[model samples]
Every structure is written in C-alpha cells, then in structure tokens.
Target: MRIFVIDSDPSFQGATVNVTVLPYEPYWDETVEGNTTRYSGVNYNLLATLCQALNFTFRRIPTREWDEVAHLVEIRKSFMTTVIYGVLPERLQRWDFTFIFEHAGLYFAMPTPVIRPSWLSFYYPLGGYVWLAILVSTLAVCIALIQVMVNEDMEKVKNAMCTEQMQ
Candidate 1:
C-alpha cells in the first residue's frame, strides 16, 4: 500500500520521520519503561518496516487524545500517524491514506465451555420433545386442579339440596 507518495524521493537518507502514536490494542500498543517508550502491534510493525525500507528513522510523537493526532498531521506538525484512522470523505480532503490494512466486522467471543459429568451431561442433550412434554403435563395438572376446585363448590350445593330433601 502507498503509505505516502514521496514525489521527490523515497529515501530519507537516515533522517527521522515524525509519527503520532495512539494506543490501539492489536493495532498499536505503547509501553513505557523508565525514560524509554516502546511500541508494538500491527500498525507499529508496519511503520517500522516502512522506515527500514525507506532508510529513515522514526520518532513517535505520543498523544493521549485522537483529535490531536489529526490536528498535528493536518497542520504539518507531524508527518503521519500509526493509529488506524478510518478514511472518510471529510478526512480525505485534508490528508492522504494508505490502502485499507484492516476490514470492519463484528466478532463474538464465546465463553469457555464448562466440563460436565457424563451422567448429568446426557440429560442436557434431550431435544425439544422433553420440554414440550413437561409443558403439556404442567398445563394438564393446572386444568385438573381448577376442575377439582369447581367440584368442591358443587359439593356445597349438593349438601344444601340434601338438607332440603330431608326437611
């Protein structure tokens, strides 16, 4: 991908190219140990590879905020950023972008499956039929209970009729 089209010359002759760094996981990760700062990941690795190819050293201009990187690069304060910025029409008018290094997609991570005992796990494999049977049985039991309750009410009426017949 054309990271930057060097019209005059591709080689920097060991000159340092300034780059803006933002910590984006998997793309770029910034680690600071004492006074020295280190960067790793795909984007950082890409920048390092480019630097080696073009015979130029790179200096990272670290920034916490994202907007600052765009502003710095826009105003010519920095050469380019290693952070993966999406190419939009508005942004395209202001800056140049390399070919798409990453694609957009959704990824879902499933939780680790729990180990189950063979005896208990066998019950889990039962299909929807078991659930259907349980539901039907439950409904049948509820209907039976309502009928029994209604019969109890009829018993009171039967007792009153019996007392009237006795009188």
Candidate 2:
C-alpha cells in the first residue's frame, strides 16, 4: 500500500477541495508492460490536476504502506511509498475527483508512459497500441516504396528493349 498525501492550494483562501484516491493492481493490468506502462496512474497526478483545475499547487510524497493491504505478506522489511500534496482555492471542494494508484513506483516520473486525456484513466493501453500501429505502418510504407522502385526499373528495361527492337 502506498500513502499519498493530497492538499489543496492555499491561494483559494477558503475553498474546500474533495480528493479521492483509487488504487490499481499493476500486475493484473496488461498495459503495465513496455511503453504502455508510462501512462499508468500514480498518486501525484490526481492531486496535481485537482490543484491545476482549482488554481492550486501540488506536490507528491511517496511512502510504503504494504502492511495496510489485507492478507498480503509484507516480505520487504522496508519499501518506498508516495504521497500527493495539492493546494487548491478554498471554493472548489464541491467537485469530486478520483486519483488512481498502481504499483509501488510512480509512473509519471518514468519516460515510457503513454500520453492520455486528463479525464481518462492514465492506465489505458493506448500507448502500446499506437506504437504498434505506427511501427506496422512504417514497415508497410517501406515495403511499398521498394516495390514501386522495382516496378519503375522493370518499366525502364521494357522501354529500352522496345527502342532497340524498333531501331
């Protein structure tokens, strides 16, 4: 279990902000592999977005709380955890936002996470799919270009033969 500390921006003066944390299981999510892993949600973004939307400030604090999870064996005597600190204008507490957490590490800090729309869950596998499509498209274009060049050369040879025969 990771501990995320979320706070609203002080600039709001008296606005109350509602912050909710959602935990996700990384191992179970197939998107956790390769480039897709980057898009997965961590504790920090939830707070940051809320702060930004409310014109507040945010920070992330990581901590280890594996003991809090039920029936899980705490094999590691020590582990790292993270917390999100956000400051929002005091007026927006009425809006509700859900923050998601998956695995012990912060995915946002990593380079490979996919870019996703703010409202959608960061863990969606779109990045991997997009990358795969791009790779396939590039390969197909290369193959087509090679075929076009071969066809052009064959046409040149046919024209040369026809000219020689006419002469």
Candidate 3:
C-alpha cells in the first residue's frame, strides 16, 4: 500500500518541517486454499504484535488503482524489519487498523477459492443412512399416534350418542 503524509511549518520563514516518508508493509500467507477458510487463518495478530514492538504506528490503506500498479510493481518477498523516524513516546501513538482491501478489491489482492454448492454433511458414507432412517421412523411413529388418537376420540363420541338414544 502507498502512503503519503505532508507536514507544514506554522512560521512562514520560507522554512518547512520536512517530514520523512516511511513505508509500512504487512505480511500474510498467500497459500490459502478454500473459501470457507476464516480470516483469522492469516497471522494478522502476529503482524499487529510486531508493529507494537516497533515504535512506528501501522495503518492499512485501501488498495486503490491496484489493477494499474499491480503489473508495474513487484511486492517484496522477504520480511521487513526497519525503523525510520524521529523519536516519540512509547505509549503515545497506537497502530491504526483497517481492512487491507475493500470487499471488491479483495479479488485483486488475493486469489479467492471458487464457492461450491452445499449439501447435507450427514448424507455421506454408510453410517449416514442409519441416522436418516432413524429420523424418518420417529416421524412416522408420531404421525401414526396422532391418527390413533383421532380415531379413539371419534369412537368414544359415537358410543355416547348410541347410549343416549337407547335411553
């Protein structure tokens, strides 16, 4: 990600605060395989911890104009650990956090796995049929009990009417 910061001096004596620009690079594994893989699979926590160790604050900028710059730029493969700047208090500044890329920009930043249609996880192997059969059987038994109760209630009502007519 490209970062730009400008510092201006309050006094207009033809003198400026001259700020040194520092670049920060965050690391993530490129070998992720599946779409279901969680974002935590990438070592983001470790990256944050490493940033804390260094005095510089880390911030993630959006990957804008990536399509135009991706071919021209070659991202460094080696891990970087360097310090550049004037000194500040250890506890004063905190690392700012943001998503590496926008949801649409993620496609350019990393190769995502193609999603596949989902099926029942339990419908695999021989043992799966046993559970299916058990569920069906339980449903059938409940249905049969309901029918029996209806029939018994109808028979009791018929018997009561017949006895009343004989009286």
Candidate 4:
C-alpha cells in the first residue's frame, strides 16, 4: 500500500532517484551488448511501475553488491534502492526499509504425469472390490483342488486294504 510516505516530503517531487540493486536474476539482471546496458527482470520491470506510482523518475546504480547500496544510501548519494535486502543491524543503521514487498515461503515444482497404454491400466483404477474378488476366487480354487487330492488318496488306501483281506 504505502511504499513510502513522500506526500509531505517536497524532496520527492521530480527527484532523480538513485536506485541500487543486487542484479537478482528473474528479479533484475543486466544484459550488455557493446555500449548498451539493457536491464530486464521483475525488479527492472517494477522500476517503471514504482516511478509512475510515486510520481518520480529513477536511475539505477551500477553496483551489484548489497553493502555498496547501503553505503550509497548512508551517504545520501541515492534517493533509494531497488534491491531487496534482509533487515540487518548494520544496514538498519544506514537506511530505513519501506513496507515489505514480498514474503518468502516454501516452493515446490511437480513432475509431469507418466502416460502409458496397457490393458491392466483400466483394471488398476477399479476399486478394492475387483481385486478382492480375484483373490477370493483364486483361494477357493486352491482349496477345492486340495480336497479332491485328499479324497483320491483315501480311496486308493481303502482299495489296497480290501485286496489284502481277500488274499
């Protein structure tokens, strides 16, 4: 909301704002081709938006280090900076930070889903009932085979005993 309360501060109007940055890639990065220094990234893009919102023009300091930016702000050579520095004691003595622009949190990237064509794929998605039925049927067949084998063995033993009695 309130980036800086420059409403009462006359030094803000049309101020040649010296912005120091850390060149955080995807946030701010300098791409130089011969004599031209072209800036791009999120912070670089934010520059135009911030200037328009505050009604002031800005120029970026060439330095990329955090300490150098702090020193520039300390000496009042720069109006402000574009770099996002952590709130540290040494830096605090030099410059005052405005409202927090961002809050860091856990970040994760998900992998792409695997694609495959198979007959089993259709059955795999079936609920527990299908698998349970398959398991129960297999078990029943196994028990029936065991019972048949035991009965056959018992009949062979009875026939051997009857032949022994006749002899």
Global lDDT of each candidate: 0.85, 0.47, 0.42, 0.78
Query: What does the lDDT come to for candidate 1?
Result: 0.85
State the lDDT at 131 in candidate 1.
71
TM-score of each: 0.55, 0.26, 0.24, 0.48
Full candidate order by TM-score, most accurate first: 1, 4, 2, 3
Model 2 alpha-carbon drift over 4 Å, by segment: 1-126
What digit string (tens of lDDT, one per residue) describes model 3 on residues 1-167?
Answer: 98965545322243221111122333232234676422232244554454455433333322334332222222422123221222335412521232233222222456685554456433543486798898999999999999999999999999999999999
Residue pairs with backbone atoms closer than 3 Å in model 1 (clashes): none
State the lDDT at 70 in candidate 1: 85
lDDT of 2 by residue, 15-133 (tens): 44332222444321114465543323444444455556667442222223433321121232212122332324541352222433432443455577666797666446568889789
Candidate 3: RMSD to truth: 16.9
Per-residue lDDT over 39-158 for candidate 4, one digit per residue giving the tens place of the 0 to 100 score: 898777778777777778878777757678778877888767776666668867766777567666667999886675788687667789988998999999999999999999999999
Instruction: Give the number of the best model, judged by TM-score.
Output: 1
Task: Assess the local accuracy of residue 97 in candidate 3 as a C-alpha lDDT between 0 and 100.
Answer: 30
Which model scores highest in lDDT? 1
Q: What is the lDDT of candidate 2?
A: 0.47
Q: Which stretches of model 4 miss by more than 4 angstroms?
A: 1-12, 33-35, 88-94, 105-167
Q: Give the candidate order by descending lDDT.
A: 1, 4, 2, 3
Clash pairs of candidate 3?
Answer: none
Error of 3 at 32 (Å): 39
